[model samples]
Target: ILHPISVLEEEDDEAVIEKYSGSCLAGVSPKLPPLPPKILVEKVAPAPVLLSMEDEEVVRAVVSGSIPSYSLE
Candidate 1:
């Protein structure tokens, strides 16, 4: 005995469902105005030079007082 073979009737029978189970996303930063050249310059005071106990106390006192101003001001 022989049984009839079943066939798919759709025209695009070869089209298979591709399941992508993952996130598709991207990050976008706001369009910011052009920054000044010096904006990126971090004004870090130079590391204090190693000094003797007396000198360290003096230097600490100096830094604790008013910050020095440039003559350009």
Candidate 2:
């Protein structure tokens, strides 16, 4: 389910940019899935280690009290 670019601002836009490379959606800025960073940590365990520290940090918020609420359908 592709979303309009406006949805990108609802979440971290960098995920699309970070995950885009080496993915099938190369050259495209796809919408970031509106999952919170906790879910990201769940998936990140088995994810590729090639991601940079910044990218890894993007998967988790810098502070626990700061986890942004993800907009769910």
Candidate 3:
């Protein structure tokens, strides 16, 4: 489920650029079903690694109320 939110503060007369890079409506063509757009050309990039000696301590601190709500998770 997705919802789109637009700002109403901008006037309606303002022009907006709508460039369609074949992302949203690329794969629904009946004739082009076999050759759909190559949305992803390669495998997804790996996630960044979190490294720190106090990583476990930080989590424990958050769970034990030793830190504030936005401290760590």
Candidate 4:
């Protein structure tokens, strides 16, 4: 006994279906705007020294308020 071989026919619409499917289905994220230009900073002078309270003066100021208060403002 001999068996007949069966062949499947390829659809003409397969190419069209593949062309419209899968990877292309996802939406692309919008491109972000370019960042602002970098600012050029000049060399700044060292900060000025404020009050220099001695340990004794600090103690006297806190205990008796005899020393003038140092303003941080």
lDDT of each: 0.52, 0.56, 0.59, 0.61
TM-score of 4: 0.29
How many backbone clashes does every candidate have?
Answer: 0, 0, 0, 0
Residues 1-73, candidate 3, lDDT per residue (tens digit)? Answer: 2234353566342432242223465456666446666686777889998858697777777788998867443
Encode model 2's per-residue lDDT on 1-73: one tens digit a residue.
3433443566676776665435455568978889765543344356656878885675566345355536211
TM-score of each: 0.23, 0.21, 0.28, 0.29
- Residue 64's C-alpha lDDT in candidate 3? 88
Segments in model 3 whose C-alpha atoms lie over 4 Å from true places: 1-36, 71-73
Could you report the Cα RMSD, in angstroms, for every candidate shown? 17.3, 29.5, 19.2, 15.0
**Highest lDDT scorer:** 4
Error of 3 at 32 (Å): 14
Q: Tell me which residue pairs clash in candidate 2.
A: none
